[model samples]
Target chain A: MRFYGYFRSSSAYRCRIAFNLKGLAPEVVTVNLRDKAHRDDAFLAMNPQGLVPVLDTGTARLTQSLAIIEWLDETQAGARLLPDDATARAEVRAFAQIIACEVHPLQNLRVLNYIKAHHGQDQDGAGAWCRHWIAEGLAACEAIAAAQDHRGAFAFGDRPGLADICLVPQMFSADRFGLATDAYPRLRAIRAACEALPAFAEAHPARQPDAQ
Target chain B: MRFYGYFRSSSAYRCRIAFNLKGLAPEVVTVNLRDKAHRDDAFLAMNPQGLVPVLDTGTARLTQSLAIIEWLDETQAGARLLPDDATARAEVRAFAQIIACEVHPLQNLRVLNYIKAHHGQDQDGAGAWCRHWIAEGLAACEAIAAAQDHRGAFAFGDRPGLADICLVPQMFSADRFGLATDAYPRLRAIRAACEALPAFAEAHPARQPDAQ
Candidate 1:
């Protein structure tokens, strides 16, 4: 198996945490997004979306971090990434989607670049954009986490499952944009619990081979 | 079961298709997005994200269309929303996320309103923004679908599944924005195939109780 990703992509970071949790280490290939390697024809051929964290599973290639994580949970032997109960699983996935769909895309590198180019946003403006979406989405996540009937040390249950997998990365991003997460006590606590684990710690952007 | 949604919400439309496919008719509650009904304390208490397509399953209220659809597939008795094979499931999910995560969020009412309020984009500007993202994302979806070795009439297989559930609504959004989808023949074909089915037809925004 081979994993293609950049060091700082939250999407790739997600798959990295999933890999560590599952106790599988695929050979890593760093696609330098800073250099626009992801836009190259070679990378586009591999993934027409020109995105990171493409998992080549020998037999098939997987795109999208959540889908790859779900596939890992289905076929992998180690820790389960999703809960078994249907409703619980839905809760975890919904939490993940709040970050993945609602928050992350609004502040994606491409989106920021587009806004900067066409929407007249400079670096500070883009950062503000990121912070706005991050803060709003995290507030929702905190609310949902606080409302959970059986909240654990993690987002969903006692173990660090899909929700934590998504939360930790978005928290990292929150910090990146200088958005203080202190307002979200539940998310802060969840991030603390997740960061203490080796799986999440090792997958941090600062720990990657391609980190500057 | 109770389903809270807005007629024009693409996310809500995805769940409506899933419900129709699963043959489960949950009680429908239309939250008027134009009137900001989702921001009411009552709705916010149910969904902190203030988004539509919340499914109350008596035991638990589910948010996030993909999560709700997956839950329906896992617990309901009907046509399978996800394929059996893990790799196949990932492909279908990746296709769905291309629309849900990458495309839909950029054109969301909240995001567009944010851009208008802060980014100096007028109505035409927002429409352009939506078209750019919709075209870019549909191009990726088309490329991926065209690359599939076993292309079926739908996005994945012979029967409509998760990918088609997402694609149909996104296609609707594209048309609403006056974006021509002719460039994405694969997606156009998939949309045509999906729209021919009663399951997809019944879920159209025009057919909803509160469409106007």
Candidate 2:
């Protein structure tokens, strides 16, 4: 198995955490997003979306971080990334999607670039855009976590799973964008618990070999 | 089971198609999005994210359209929304997330509102923003579909599963934004095939009771 990813990408970070949690070591290939390597024809052939991290499971190349993580959970043996029950699984997935879909996309590099290029946004303007979406989305996630009937050490349960995997990366992104996360106390608590785990700590962007 | 949704929400439309495909009709409750009904305290109590398309499954209230659809696929007795093989399921989900995470969220009402309020975009500017992301995202979807080996009538296979469920509503949004479908032959063909089904046809935003 091989993983194509960039160190600082939240999506790639999510997949890295999932890989560590599942105790699988796929060979890493750094597709340098800073250099626009993701836009090259070779990378586009592998994933038309031109995004990371793409997991090549020897037979097939998978794109989209959440899909790759879910694939790992389904095929890998070490840890169960999702719950067994259907309803509980839905709740966990919903929490994850709040970050994946609602939060992350709005503040994506491409989106920021678009705003800067077309909307005349400078670094400060782009920063505000990132912070606004991150703060709002994290607030919602915190509310859901606080409202959960059986909140434990992690987002969903005692063990860190999909929700925690997604949360940790977004929290990292929040810090990168200079978004103060004090408003999301529940999310902060979950992030602290997750960061304490070696699986998450090892997957941090700063720890990756590709980190700048 | 009670489903809280608005007619025009693409997320809700995806769930409606999933429900139709699953042959499960939960009680429908319209949460009018235009009037800021989703922001009401009662609705936020149910789903703190304040998004439409919350499925109350008697057991738990589920948010995030993809999560709700997956839950329905798991618990309901009907057509399978995901393929059995792990690899195949990942491919299907990756295709769906291309729209769900990448495309839909960029054009979400809240995001558009933010851009307009902050970036000084008029109606036309917002339309351009919508068109840019929609076109780019769908081009990726089209490329993926066109490149797939053993292509069927739909996005994945003969069965219109999760990928097609997501593709159709995104096509609807594309049309709403006046983006021409001619540029995406593969996606257009998939959308044509999906729209022929009663499940997809009946779930159209115009067919819903609350559609204005």
Candidate 3:
């Protein structure tokens, strides 16, 4: 397996964490999003959407961080990331999508470009937009996490699974944007627990080969 | 099973159509997003994200349309929306996420509100912003749909599976934005095929119980 990613991409970071957690390390093939490499012919040949964090299974490439994660959970065997029960899967998935779909997309490079070009937001303005969305999403996620009675130092249960994989990266981005996360105590605690793990630590953007 | 949805929500519409195809006809409840009803106490009890298209499976409430649809696909045993093979399932999910994760989130009402307040886009400017993203997304989707040889007239093959369920609603929103999708013949054709079906037609946003 191979991975296409950029260090600063939270989505890619999520994938890296998943790959590491599943104890399956794929060859890291960097797609330089900053230089518009994703839109270049070679990358488009791999993913038409030109998004980062595509997992290349050698036979097929998977797009979308959540989809890649799901594919991993389904195909892999050891320490399953998602629970087997249908309802449990939905619960974990909802938390993941709250981050992956609702929060991350608003703060992506393309949306940032739109803000810069169409909205005339400076870097700080862009960061503010990013923070605002993160705050809203994190608040909702906090509600869900706090509601979990069975959790043992993690977002869902004792194990750091799908939701934890997604949560940690977003908080990383949030800290980068200088967002105040004191409101989400559960998120803070769970993130601290996840950060202590070797898998998430190794997958940090600053640790990636493409880090500038 | 019961589904709470707003008529114009492409996300909700996707789940509704899936339920229809599966012959589940989950008791349909309505959440009017325009009135800020999704964020109301009653609705948030079901989904903390306060987003529409929450599918209550009797055991728990399912948020995220893709997650809900997938759960239904797995547990309901009806139309078999996903392919049996792993690679095939990954492909279908990748296509679905392009719209669900990448496209839909950008055009959502909350983002438009932010654009209006922060970017100084009036309703018209916000709508323009919406269309621009739609065009960019559909262009990628068109490339994707045309690139594959699915078995059916749908986005993948002949079967109206998950990708098509996601695609058709996205196309509906595209037209609502006055996007000149004549350039996207494959998308339009696939959408026409899906829309022509009673399941898709009945799932149209305007046809929903809370359409007014």
Candidate with the greatest lDDT versus the true structure:
1
The residue-by-residue lDDT of candidate 3 on B1-212, one tens digit each, is: 78888899889989989988898887888787888999899888877888988887787888899889889988987798998888789888888888888889999998888888888889788888889888888988998889886556888887899999999889889888888899899999999999889989998888876777
Clashing residue pairs in candidate 3 (N, C-alpha, C atoms within 3 angstroms): B150-B156, B150-B157, B151-B157, B151-B158, B152-B157, B152-B158, B153-B158
DockQ of each: 0.93, 0.91, 0.82
lDDT against the true structure, each candidate: 0.94, 0.93, 0.88
Q: Which ten residues in a row have the lowest lDDT in candidate 2 chain B?
A: B148-157
In candidate 2, which residue ranges exceed 4 Å CA deviation? none
Tell me the TM-score of each prediction against the true structure.
0.99, 0.99, 0.97
Candidate 2, clashing residue pairs? Answer: none
- Return the lDDT, model 3, position B95: 86
Rank all candidate structures by their lDDT, best first, as comma-separated numbers.
1, 2, 3
What's the TM-score of chain A alone for every prediction? 0.98, 0.98, 0.97
TM-score of chain B of each: 0.98, 0.98, 0.96
- Candidate 2, B177: how far from true, in Å? 0.5
